[model samples]
Target: MEQILDLETDRENQTAGPSGRMHLGGNDLTVDAGRVVLDGTVVGYLYENGFLRSAREQTEDDEDPDTGQWRLVDDLEGCDFQGTTQDGLPLSLPGPSSPGPTGSLSYNGRDYQVMQGRISNAQHKILGEYYGGGRFVLRDARTNTERRSLDEGSVINFSFAGTASDGRDLSEQYTRPLYRDQISYHENEIIRYFQDFDRLDQQQRDYVIESMRIWAASGILQIVRKKEGNAALGNVKHGAAGVTRVRTGMVDLDAEEFERDIDLCARFGPLAVITTRVPSYVEVRVNLVVSHEFGHQLQFCLSQAAQDRIDELYQARLARSIAKFPPPSAYDGGSELVHADQVMHREFISGYAKASVFEYWAESVAAFSFKESRKLLRQLDPGIFSILEQVVFTPEKVMSAVLCEQILNLQASLRFGGEFGKNLLD
Candidate 1:
């Protein structure tokens, strides 16, 4: 673990960590002229948030041969921090001022190197200067001033999780990426934008983060800028924005993937009714892909021992439920998975859930994690809802206790019971 160096908290002279110095307090950490100061050093600058809107890094001398313009660096914030207009078109702002970003990024076999860069609002380009094999420095993109940088100590991989999903503990399966992706962001405009977002009405932005950070922690969603496309692909190709591997907790949601589906997800409103673009026979595919993928990761992290017990519990519960109420003698024999409004909906959240026990558990797990999805599941089948609540979630804790706790918290706002009980709350 990188020791959090503090002037008062530490006994010895401290060394800067990969993130350098950090000023952390809940809503009290103020920014002046875009920098965060801790102890006496300016750690990192802040970005201003506003309406937004992409591009590359260039040096002072690096010029576009054809256009005769410097190759403009991608304003990571402008591409990231966005909003929508009253007419519902994308609104890209150019105001938030920021120093740079701190999180690590993984890419195709190599981590991008971090380097000192210049950001100029005048030229609209970030000029990074990285030496061949020496240490890197970061600078304010606007003023061309070198800023302090933090060094990371270690990237911890989980050690004790009982065992692996397969036969043995596949501890060696996922090797943490050592290489770093070197990039910088514009400071002045982006920093100003971020500092002002809390003051602006959320509806003003294209996406308001009421619970996005909390929600995304499920699989540790890390969006990377590898390539741009309408679909997401990594670890394997899925024509979607996000992919979660059962073997490893590493998840990737392409920026384009979120961009493509968010509007559709919003269309369902309050309910966020899922509608799929997968061209399947099922009438709709919910925008619960994030929730769905999180389910897969949670289940994947479980040891074989834990999985066996979960299956045993589900089977026993299935037998009891079948005795109380029989399955339809006539099978719908549908090709794609489906969710219906009728009760006793074939002991599955949807036709998709019926494909297999794993799929059934995953679909219900999503319902277990989300609000609108859970509502739909309960309306479709109370028994299955109970099953998801008890069997799967109970086992899920063995893998990710924190994630399960979050789901529990997220669902706390909802109330449910029998018909009269439901009316009582309303």
Candidate 2:
């Protein structure tokens, strides 16, 4: 029981009478002037002159009628075509040569022939297609579908070569090559990760930056993650002098003296900002510390207040402890010498001088800039106020009268304009 479907056989010359001929499954079929053979089974026995026909189910009109066409349920309800072969096979339909369905594709340096027609239905494409050529149809190996085209060279390379149900020698050409794009998906994933990072709003970014500052001050500074570690970083320094130094440790400072400590150490441009590790943490507090350090730098950059303050503190210690320091330079500016009854001698002496006279003046400026900052810390934690009070005012001292007035004037001008003194303090 071998069923053979031959191409080039005429329909009138064919004979089907269930005698001395191989029994093809589902009735004897033919194709393109060739004898058709469905080498499967024949169960349902309904015959006219021992030649039989089986009805096929019908499908929706939108489907490919050739593939979608089906017989009525009643037509095949009791039909049991005998099983001629366990393997599914197709046979040629008796008629003039007609294309089964044709498509051409090239892969792996070889051309292929696809027998299944291009899928016109969207669903079929989603599920994929099959391959066909010669006398039979086979599954498309490239996309793993029934409606796929195969190039002979590609098919052999992909390992697909055999006879289809139609008894036609299939050329490996019907199978498409498995082509994969490696870079596209990888690039997409990278972009997606960056987008996820970007999706974080401003508040989240700020929180992260704040945490970094805390860790840095707490002596935990190190490269947690360097995006471009080997790239040259511009030269910058954190010392009082312009010298490069890499930091690797933390320092403990009285949370009270955070601003004071940072101010004493910071210098403008090329100087590192000062910060200290504290046990209790708050993003706002760390932000205040950074503001204070930069405040020192801004003051130094703008005026001579820093040098002046340093001189004053030094002279105070000299007068009390050693008593041989030279007297401060004479008040050289044309400003009037105005002294208050409660002002310290140092204040009177310094205030009578011009605005541009001393180095400590920069410290005064930084202190002025940090007033609101100090208040913010106090609002967050009141204990920080005592630290501020100790540095600026005490039982044995008063700030230089001129420095104090300058600070007050700077505040007034900023808050209420240059004509601020015209109004009473509210």
Candidate 3:
């Protein structure tokens, strides 16, 4: 049976658990621990090893009795239990509630996979009792596991100088080569996204502003204008609408060229403006360009599994390309896609996608996030849509979800901090 989660629920009573019963995998679920409040009106669960963790786990000094790998921490005081599975599925534990020996989250008539809690923290506002061993953790919203691997460092800003540093120490960077007009345009665009600032929490708001700060600091966002009479109408160092590096995050946008393309799109059609095979049913040119570049930036923020999955898919596509577009063969052609086998062109969003896995990912992410274009992309390529829905966009990819949460958190943050918003190659 295809399980559909109820998104619209009563916010006040919305955090209730097994109070209303539900079944998963043909099994019965019950509410053992009652509802407790977290800050910001968030409520959480406290169930035994039913779905989240094993009852046999440890809870002593810095040891997650369940895994015994990392030090099981017991500082659950006023902390949100955000976590995810290793493969990028999200799991929720009860709380701002204290930890207990056994715990799990029961939501919408379903038991979300979560770590059973032990109250090691002090007290709740209403339920004044000592809680056990729930540790402070950064979590993936959808998938849950007892522990996370400490391979990729925490998601902080990357130094434009190719070094990584804890937030406290890094020197600030600037948006390179942006002229007065360009800078204002960017600041205005940044502010446009920030217009909904009140909708976000302090953290989300901080993230948006800080993310911009990092991009600006990284010496990225180099902008150039193609003059009206410049004969080279379509000159790009990298083939697509814009280009950026996997690590450097350097991005170059042809504002004049793009403006020219938009004008052409109006005169001839949107098809004349876009490089991808995706049909021009709407404004897919300029918007898609910005979204696409953002997609590349988003790629740097994802967790290992999410990144791996992106690489895996791109490699699969690349493997086929290597076969079809044999080196220096009869198919060697001038245009990016002319050399591609029929299958390559058919599967990708645009002809630009055929150039590289990075390009394909960037194009798809742009298509996905850009609302007006999403409908056509889904219709044209359902398979790609499914992968994006199930993997990259899942709330369980913790690092990835962090981006979403901050974006969502902007609401709370605005009243409180502030905000946000893909990609890969094999």
> lDDT of each structure?
0.32, 0.26, 0.34
Q: lDDT of model 1 at residue 282?
A: 31
TM-score, ranked from best to worst: 3, 1, 2
CA-only RMSD, every prediction: 21.7, 31.1, 16.6
User: What TM-score does candidate 1 reach?
Assistant: 0.32
Best by lDDT: 3
Candidate 2 per-residue C-alpha lDDT over 1-426 given as tens digits, one digit per residue, 9 for 90 to 100: 111221111122232211122224334432211122344433221111111323222223412213434221112323223221111222221101222333433322223333232111211111112344322222322222222222231122122244443556554442222322232211222222122324445543332233223212211111111110111112222222101112322211223343333333332221122221321211111222322223233222222443354445535533432132222245333222322322222221222112222312222222223333334334432322332232222201223233333333222211111111212111
Model 2 regions lying over 4 Å from their true place: 1-237, 240-289, 301-306, 314-426
Q: Across residues 71-118, which tens digit of lDDT does each residue of candidate 3 receive?
A: 222333222333332233332434333343333322111122222332
Q: TM per model?
A: 0.32, 0.17, 0.37
Assess the local accuracy of residue 373 in candidate 3 as a C-alpha lDDT between 0 and 100. 48
